[model samples]
Target: MISHTAAITIYTKTGERREMAEATPYEEQRRRQVEANKRKLEELQLHHLSAAIREAAAAAKPSLVKKRKARVPLDVADAVMEPVRRSGRLANLPDKPVYREKVPDFGMKIRRTYGSVRRDLTNRVYATDDARSYAISKAEDLEQELDSSFPIFIKPMTQSHVTGGFWLGLPIHFCRKYLPKRDEMITLVDEDDDESDTLYLAMKRGLSAGWRGFAVQQKLVDGDCLVFQLIEQTKFKVYITRASSYYESED
Candidate 1:
């Protein structure tokens, strides 16, 4: 049996009291439960890894068998039956079926824009330092010449390796002139602005005039600089040029 004791000790002229307690059964049980949970989680991870290995082995068996069957035998004749053997291997290879789809060829399209700017106009701003001023000037010029609220995508020109050279500011007007019947909504791909910035400020600075600003790290080609206004979401594609290439058919 354990015995309980109470004592008062004084280290100096002032009196001080101290107490020490033994662990209770409830505390011990809680500690054991926490340890058990940790072990259970480790076991679950091991089980998941084992399952993944088994699934991979099951998927690879058929592919291995097909490759083995396609392997050429060493006993075959070299000169007498060379064309037949080559044709046989070609026949066994997988066929790539072509499907027709109408894809746009926006040669040098300006898709989006990204950057940051200060909130006030009274604040002295320089063209080199102020992103908002640059965007506004570009937008105003495009609007006056094009006569439409064409979608202008905005992005940063800092630290970003622009593969395509800067936009010549003609594609936006051209798209507006040609694709006039489509919806024109400006989308700002603001790489510099965080979620806290107001939509009004972004629009006033000639950035995409809307609340729906998305961030995308586009893979751009070298010597390419995009500048244009999109007519609709369907007309725009994220990383379209880098994703695929087209082959022309002989007429």
Candidate 2:
């Protein structure tokens, strides 16, 4: 025969009740089971998160392609003439009129003669200011008395006594008096216009005569009757021997 023990109950002045039974082994086992289930659920969630991360990485692949861009020459004539076109001063003048030409023999002869003649004629003519005034007066007198149709060349004397360096300052009216027709005015191709057609001929002549940088300075005039400086030095000299040939030429 087994007897079940009953717990004693005590009541204090305050009404409160307390459970006297301790936890059974079954209850403790149930609590441990609940905790274990929660742990397994957390592990499963971690596995799913890792799988999703791997799938996302596989979907995002890198590309291996490149992108490329295309490259044009310049017009030389247009570039060169553009500046001249923009300048208002050259607008009225015909572009073709500025064409280059070969220097004529007559023009070259004048330039070569000018330097030597000035030295010979005016070397001792002016010493003091009074003498220079007198010489100028004489030049004016000669200019006035000379025939209008005569070809005249005038140049300023250099302060230095160089042999062949005379300043060409002849007035244009003086040149026109002799060469009235515009067509009669001669032009020369020189070192300045080496690439032009006229220059090609000039170069051939210069080479045949063993010269370099030869040029012909020609006279020009305006409507105002002003004489232009008719002579200029060329980069090449034909030597006195070659110059003699030029002098003999009729043109």
Candidate 3:
């Protein structure tokens, strides 16, 4: 025993339908307020996130510091980069020294005594040693060879000649000469053969006295030799190969 109810239908003439319910003014305003509140919250979150990122970057960044330079000593300033001398080497300098020499004085007197003939006697010397060793040694081979070595018993006379087995002469040719002007020593140099028998004289020292002094000392005016034989007055022959003791000189 239930009864059925039917809804009321309103039909337009052209057959259009109307809404069943409509929105209220309060609902529209509430929806708009909700949307605005959502937008303000999103903006606030973004601003907070940006502020946090800036703070983190500032804390992580490095700070800058100032630097200082090292100092050098003033005493050794000039010694730097200067060239130094090597080992065992010397350097250039000044104030050196110098040197010199000396001289001496001469002492002695030489002169001619006898037995110098016509010959060149410049700057030469002689002695009994000057007599050639071979010539006197080869006496057997020499012409006019005496039976033995003989000395001449000289006689002061008007003429000079050879006597019987005796030879005589004024023998003033055996001495040397000294030139005072040139200060040169003139020595005896023998340049003759047996036919001439020219004598030359030379010596480191000179006659202490003249030939007359020598003749008196050696008794040459009388006779002195290796062999002796008096044939007559001022006429004698003797072997005369002997050292010259009659002549003395200074060293």
Off by over 4 Å in 3: 1-107, 110-209, 222-251
Candidate that beats the other on TM-score, 1 or 2, i.e. the better one: 2
- Scored against the true structure, residue 207 in model 2 reaches a CA lDDT of 19
lDDT (CA) per prediction: 0.37, 0.36, 0.33
Query: lDDT by residue for model 2 over 1-251, one digit each (tens)?
Result: 73333355655668776545444677778889999999998988987898999998888855556544322125655655444588787788776755544454433232242212233434322244443444445444445654544344433232321223221222455433433232222333332343211111221221111111121122111110111122322221111112122223435
| Model 2 C-alpha RMSD to native | 19.3
lDDT of 1 at 120: 31
What is the Å distance of residue 193 in model 2 from its true position?
34
Ranking by lDDT: 1, 2, 3
lDDT per residue, candidate 3, 1-251, as tens digits? 73233345556888976433334566678879999998998978977899999999999977666555665566675556444556444444322433421111223332323322222325222334323232233322322354333332222211111111122323343122211221222221111211111111223222122222223223232112222222222223323332233242212
Segments of candidate 1 deviating more than 4 angstroms = 1-118, 128-172, 177-183, 186-208, 211-251
TM-score of each: 0.18, 0.22, 0.14
lDDT pick, better of 1 and 3: 1
Decoy 1 TM-score against native:
0.18
